[model samples]
Target: MSLFDTYIAVDWSGGNDRGAKPKRDAIWACAAGEEPVYLRNRQVAEDWLAARLEAEAGRRVCVGFDFPFGYPAGFAEHLTGREDALALWDWFEARIVDAPDVNNRFDIAGEINARVSGVGPFWFNGLKREVNHLPRKGLDRTNADFPEKRLVEMRAKGSFTCWQMAGAGSVGSQVMMGLPVLARLRRKYGAKVWPFEALDSAVAFVEIWPSLLAPSFPGGMIKDAAQVRAVARAMAVMDGQGSLELALAKGEGSGAEGWILGVGAEDLLEAAMKPIDMPRPPKLRDDCFALPAGVDWTPVDEALARLDAALRCVVGVEQVSHTQVVGRVVAEPVTARRSNPPAPNSAVDGYGFAHDATGEGDQVLPLLAGRAAAGGAYGGTVPHGSAIRVLTGAVLPDGVDTVVLEEDCSVTDTHVAFRGPVRPRANTRKAGEDVVAGSDVFAKGHMLRAQDAGLLAALGVDALPVFKRLRVGVLSTGDELVDPSQNAPPDRTYDANRPMLLQLAAAWNFEAVDLGHVRDDRAALKARLDEAVGQCDVILTSGGASAGDEDHVSALLREQGNLQAWRIALKPGRPLALALWQGVPVFGLPGNPVAAFVCALIFARPACLKLAGAAFAEPQGFMVPAAFEKRKKPGRREYLRARMGSDGVEVFASEGSGRISGLSWSDGMVELPDGAMDIARGDLVRYLPYGSFGL
Candidate 1:
């Protein structure tokens, strides 16, 4: 069954009321498989829609309106002191004062402009008489505090700016006037608005642009009427095909600025009207950390490839406040809510004037009485053949397209002189230049840094959805091991691997849980494993992982859990046991401290990050010249603890896996390939720095 049983489209009007007769610019609405119905004014249109919706009770319906349901990001908060589109709607609904033929839309526009600036971002007064701050022409207004177009407008080609009020292609007035009606209908019917709320309601409203589809009806019908009918039928057809739900899915920049229905699904709409077959998206499976069959002795590259294929983001998402998001992975794309700098402003301290006002050569122009500073804009427009003093970061006054730096100009009490041939629109930052509204700032799986938090703050984002941190439990198994705080006999050594592994997990931004140490007993290790599964998402065991008699970790996994014993061809680390205990992934590492650390860096770190909802990233390595020479065999790969010396990269004095002091002595690792290699002094070799592993 289709999600929606009915679809309706409305072509709204923002101009003064037309008489009680069928006309072109009056409000028009059409239901699927029905003729267009014309309403004389806003009041009649609202009444007709309410009646139609009331008659369609118990049926799922979607209403599409041509006017924008929202303004650009930051506009709602700027006007209403809250970052909510519905609040802005309420704000307008309380003060709009709409009647059949006479409304205070122009006065309201002027009032809104007065709050933002004495001059406007809102313009085009269609009335004959003047309004307080509203201008008649777009060029007469200074829009230095907000972007002229919304993010959706930039993406939807040929879309009109929501700033224009009553001139040709003006959508701004419609938004200001239409939102009040939408608010009333939503409150009365409990209908949800698309892109703002989840589409779970029986009656849902969507923002539509009728121009997206060409209308085909008998000749002589009003263009607006034809459009509403065409759009309404198209929506119903697409809904039946099941492609409409995909089109309504929330995307980048749709959070605050809203979205046009079928913006990216133009092809689907066209094909749906023709009744053609549509492709459905494939279903995704969460088979994270699942091992493939038939894996035995593995190469370094092959092991890494297998791990990459088996891993996916296994953590759930949460909306975290911007202040606490650092080091958290983004669950979705974080887009810019508002542009940085917001509007065009002077880049340097200068004399601002219109660039085309004069011809080439040295020129002089009268100075305006006041200056445009960073906090305040010049109240009046900058006339031709005149200039105004403007400081760095100041919003350029209307008609001022260019600025000549103070250092390049000669100033007097009433005038300023500068060399001619200045470039048009020079020394000025364009609106949305640094960061554009609706543009993606960070993609999914991105880890937030301190600077990222600052950028989000500047964009007015209070909170964002981020994946929860992965929980990693560290366990060590060895009969000869004891805690560092306890006295140990000569046969026993202090437990170094557990503490190191715990710290490493913490450094990698995972929630580190100390599962404590387990001795070489099958029943005791099993109890610890069961407990870890309840407390952690993943477990790490550092000893008794090989196929020896005392290898309880591998033996227990083989008997009670799913186990994959991988004998990797590598120095220091060879026997790697991977398993799933109670559906939680467990990594089994070697007993030697240095070998365990190497294996953790090479394999476990990236896999853990992937499970934590971070993108799988390979450890970055660069080539550095070797300071020492050595001959290697063709069978096993080797990594020597190393650091950059005065001449080149210097390897540790020994290649023994038990040399725990070598790890602390070195800053990175020097990797040797599997094939036989004869390395001499000054021969370049790949160097993997500790920092590259996120240490």
Candidate 2:
């Protein structure tokens, strides 16, 4: 119905046709049009693909390829040396989502590639990468060999077709092996990728990202940082990730060892090529890109660099001990400073005296008259056959333990009639009963909450020193951006981001100072940005951040700010940009209200927390049931503003991030089905929970 008449994705692979091996090797393809069909096989794969393109010629057709579109710096040597290196990526990055980077450097490609080299039982499946132990309707199960060996054999035969390149174990393995790096690179350097041949049709049709007509960063392997970044900047245009925003301006690592092709990869790859010269850098070919598998990007290495850089900047915040400060981000772990009860004290308002030793009713005894009132202690011992008079909060006199209430005791001038003697230490609050001294009450990086404040107060803490919040600046830019005082233009509309942004910033506990909106003029925008630097810690700009001719933010930013990453291969919020200006971190939020909100949730909110010096600031979304049947293509993540409906949480059918109305109809955004999983009504879907999301 739309301009994209059909979207087809092909996953073509080699079939061992000598009858000795079954052409079970698969090459998948799909076309989204009047009718969408998925094709798998070398013979049928290309003809079907060419026919669809012809039928939909002149119309935008989207396709996905599972082959190694670009290999390492020198493919011939790299492929020859490594035994089907692509097979190693079967571990988790691409297929298994949420696989955390728990250890040293969790490089999905490198890790899996290494394992596949000499393995008995491999971890996962390739074809339908989602092919777990469970059987599906369309797939015919087969014992596919390790992707690395598959590629080595294919490359040896010199018979590598696009189909073989796409569906062979190498193609399936390497493409997927390279998936995380590609995803991150798409984030690192905005790149508009051309899919090879093996993607699903409906899902492949629309440029998939966080917005409409957005392209899923066609994945590719690049060797140079400059190239990776260059591609990222360019991709920003196609995907609307983040645009450079200099006019609205303001301010401002990980794993090791494999699939690394650019810059220093030669040293390692060279050693890999020439065994004796291990660890030395390689001299890679200029034309190709490196595969990320079998590579190690040590976390320790990056963390050291980060720490080295981090320690350079003297932390602006002051750390105060729990005993000295009332509210602070606990720098050092805090142990209970003192025992809650200095000594045994009274618990009740009733009398505090040594009653009869026997269980008797109202025993008349000589009241060893002594007042151990809370502040004024009697500091004396009591003898037998006598008692001491004490108030509720009084410390018990020596030799006279426990207390009898006035109701349980009778009064006399010097003698008192009381109930039988109570148990030892009864009616008394014990020492250290509440909190033991020297035990950890709070851990390092604990954010002071309300109850924590009260506890600190009770511990005799006054004004507690806390980490100073990072100063953040917000600037909105656009030709149509007018303040409340400005008169309306014939075609201009009021900026919808400022008020909501201000409110959202405040909600994150950021000391957000609104720089107001700057007109389309570059000088004005730059001036506003310069002024903001003196007053803010980070700068945020909306609107004029795009590459459009009228948009000045991009050009201004390119002067000093490298567009590190923009345009996500997802929907809504894809146009967001993350950049650095004058060493300060700047985020370019899309002008669309809904896009801005969702992007802010993903990027801005986290950045604010990081700058706020609050480790507690986190963006963790939840999974809830979808109240309605929502359909989507594979390859791109989708964010749909959804309300916590009566059933669970129904996503608004109208999920255009550009549409402000969708935001009003939902509680928060739902991250719809990721690649491979088709979301049906009533199925639980991943989403940013209402708590983490700021309206």
Candidate 3:
């Protein structure tokens, strides 16, 4: 029913095959993405592969074979004739994407003739095609002594590297070869390379067995294997695995070579890229639109428009309790009922009295009678040259203008000598001087920050009601996905989104509950959904949200709920599905871990907060440039993962949503919109702080 039934793998070597040697040199067999089927010996592996292809007549299959389709012809001339004879042999390996005629052999016999007979003499004339090859004995196509001599020479100096784009002098390898580049990549790109075994397996699944007789595309990277695995796991957040898978399936392209992205996107991208041990430098491509054709590039209004439209859906003016006011926007116009410090009591700890009330500086006015503490009033008015005692925060008598400190007045027989000349309003606080009781305190619809909270406390409010936190139910699917809490195999890792989602929900005022991860099977997912609908106001699931052959989320929704949106044109979170289940919004996030986290931040986080009665704000990416060149498809918006770059804007690198490093390293992500921007190096852009992920 699919394009290919089975895949084949062959690890090829120079000359005839490993059978020509003492041991097995080729890894030959069937492999979908794992162990190969090992059909026979190196040389024989090809024949067995040919037979397998023939056995499945008319059906197309993918086969993975290891060999440099072209090699240095001097290897053959070195075996049989003089050194100058190398001129008669032509090099035959090197390739460009889809440029088949450049070096591919016309047939097996022709390849043998070219190698053993030095058929393409012109290749050696140009120094560019020099290569190292080994031949086997008794093989009609090659001289028996050639391989041994070549190997000896290789041991002495030259080394043989597999013909992946890495060794092809491609942009990626070029960037990787430099020490500065390596440091930058690790510091910036992190690890995003895939292993030979993994790549071989993916190709094999496509039944490239016929390729056993041929060479593979040799598209592997020179990065730490462990990092590659980690990136793959991270990529699970978004359901996207690698460059090829996302390119072919979602048509979301990564056509650039280098890029600097905001931190958030970098984290999301890291989650999507396959993990490796150390960071590897990636070559950038230009399959996207550069900012305008010159300088003066500005953000397209449509992008802002899109952002605004989305925001409008959930943002609203709403009244909220002062207790619940922290971080919530005030929707109504608010005014302070009274000014701060409504009345002036005492500025110092000393008694209050009339001006010239001090003896030294202020007259020491004797304590006639203590004025009541705050709120109690003095009944009678005072005469000229008089003072009254007042404590801190106490109400002064009606007749008292001010009170002099006891040290300032010479008190004798109730006649306190007011030393200094009396200034009517000097020491006394006039009524309405501290504050007018009718001023506005705060406005409505404003986001309440910490200072705002303090203001409310000062206003005498102890407990308050805030907008209720949104309650979100979390779920995941796929039989391959497992609960990380329990033990798992070498291939298994714990589910990451549940905890991440919970944290994000908390940050955004959404109450998140873990509903557990499930399998791709419909019945199980449905059962989980049924449980979720009863307790949660919003339902969120990671994985099984795409349209893969085995994916079942859509089918389950059709059977049990109402699906509103299927596939989105959005990058990194393309497989996102939105629906209404039992009147509660359901966000079927992509199964890929990276996509899940990013999408949750994008849609689910805001939606949950809005449902919880909190004002909604959209999270956006900044428009920084490529720290390095980045590749992308022409049409869809690409989410590139990058670091907070030393430059302070963003430094773009690997972790392209296909890699986990993108999400992990990024403080935020840069939006590589479809037509206007390329995220090239040194561009000014909007910096979207990791917006509103509750936790």
Candidate 4:
């Protein structure tokens, strides 16, 4: 069966009435397999739509509207005191005054602009008289409070901004006037709006772009009429082919700004009316971290891009107590079970009374017998002209809308007296003020912190789904190295890389597994890797990662696994061998202690976090004036060990990769761009603290 029995498309408009004749720049609607019809105005359009929906009861139907369903992210919360699009619809429906030939949309727009900023986010009034706050041209408005375009508009190329009101391509006025009608229909018919709500309802509304598909128009047909008809027919055809469900897939921010159906599925929509050969989906690869071919001496940014595109979370999820979830990556979004504070409560130790009891001058009120304290609230309603003593966190008794702080009152055994002019609902916290019940508190892939634990407890979330810790196996290679605990020969050195890497992995909240040290023999390295694949989700090896003859780490990977020895254009570290052995990812790091540390921080850390089921996030860096002067050549990025000093950021004296002391000498790193430049003492440079990299 098809997803929908009927499909409807509407070309919406916001301007004043244009007589009874069918024309452009007016509302028009078309149902699949039916003729396009002209709508005189919004009132008639709403009536006709309601009648159609009533007649189509019990049959699955989908309606597409041309105007935007919502504004940018913060606009709803700023104007309506709620972050929901439907709430904004109700807000507009309550305030907007619409009639057959005239409306107060421009005035309402001006009022909204006055609330946000006097200049305008909503502009271009078409009225003959100048409208205050609403500018006549886009150039006169300063839209600094919010974004000019919604997130969906940015992705859909050639789409007009939803901020302009009277311009040729403006959709702002249409949204202001049209959302109210849709809101009424949705409430009356129980129809679900796509993305904002689930699309399981018999009647569903979706955002649509008529220009998304190019269809042949019948001769002498108006462009708006032809567009509506074409879009409706295309949607119906796609539904019959069982491909319309794919077009309704939800994306990021779709719930907030709404997505245009078929915007991302242009090819499928174009081929809906024709028979075509569909290519078979490619086979899934077992090796996910395999680098692309011909990638040689890649730039640092390019290498990061490749890694971000290739990696996916490889761990399984389990339910853990909120108490133990710190440092764990969330596998599912956690919604609040109850609101913070749970009920209206006093914000200070004070006397609570109804605001209307006292006015004009100093008034005296008699005290109630009982007092409301934390965990012990007064049972009865607070009578007018009477005050009840209440402490912070104590639930406000009925009939009490205001609280006068005890410090501001002269209290005796029988009565409490305070000054006049107490604000309504003063010194009292409203229920759901901090967090509302059923609202999303944390999204999937969020790494929990200690503060998150307190929030979870407050929200009554006892347990949550979290990904299992990634098991990272650390293995150090080289015949000249021995464990620090062991007696080493004069020619041998201690295996510092293994201990350092293992500790770093643990510090990053991963399960660090000691794979021990392996010599430069190919057979020994192969045995160690074969064992590591089963015990670890990822294997990290230092030394023997280069293309040298004794580079058994690279040799074994090239011979047995999918290996790509990426020579990155970065100072201190260059050779980075990424491979997959037996479906487990492996990171081959440098032999030098300094290079291994830098490469691990800059490259391996983010990749590992993603693989451990955490969301992809770049380490934040801040710009600071440089304390030292240096002239750097182009082609490779340089990172100098740095620390914040009195002048600005001070770098270590040397840039040698073998100087392991430099790593410990500084608290952070200063990064230089790839282009050649002369950095003076006063010049600004990007600095990244160790904490920013999850140190």
Candidate with the greatest TM-score versus the true structure: 4
Q: What tens-digit string does per-residue lDDT give for candidate 1 at 9-84?
A: 9999987688878888779998865679998889998999899889989877899999998888888899889878
Q: Candidate 3, overall lDDT?
A: 0.44
In the range 26-121, model 2's lDDT, one tens digit per residue, is 333333211123333333444565555556544444444434433322222333453222222222234533312111121333243343333211
- lDDT, candidate 4, 29-103, per-residue tens: 988756799998999899999999998898778999999988987899897788888899999999999988779
Whole-model Cα lDDT of every candidate shown, in order: 0.84, 0.48, 0.44, 0.85
Model 1 per-residue lDDT at 223: 87
TM-score of each: 0.59, 0.48, 0.45, 0.59
TM-score of 1: 0.59
Best by lDDT: 4
| Selected candidate, larger lDDT, 3 vs 4 | 4
Candidate 4 deviant stretches above 4 angstroms:
1-293
Off by over 4 Å in 2: 1-315, 318-337, 351-427, 437-440, 485-487, 620-625, 661-665, 676-682, 686-689, 693-695
Model 4: clashing residue pairs? none
Predicted candidate 3 versus true structure: per-residue lDDT over 92-134, tens digit per residue: 2111111211222223222433554433221111114433331
Write down the worst ten-residue block by lDDT for model 1.
275-284
Error of 4 at 375 (Å): 0.7
Q: Model 3 — TM-score against the truth?
A: 0.45
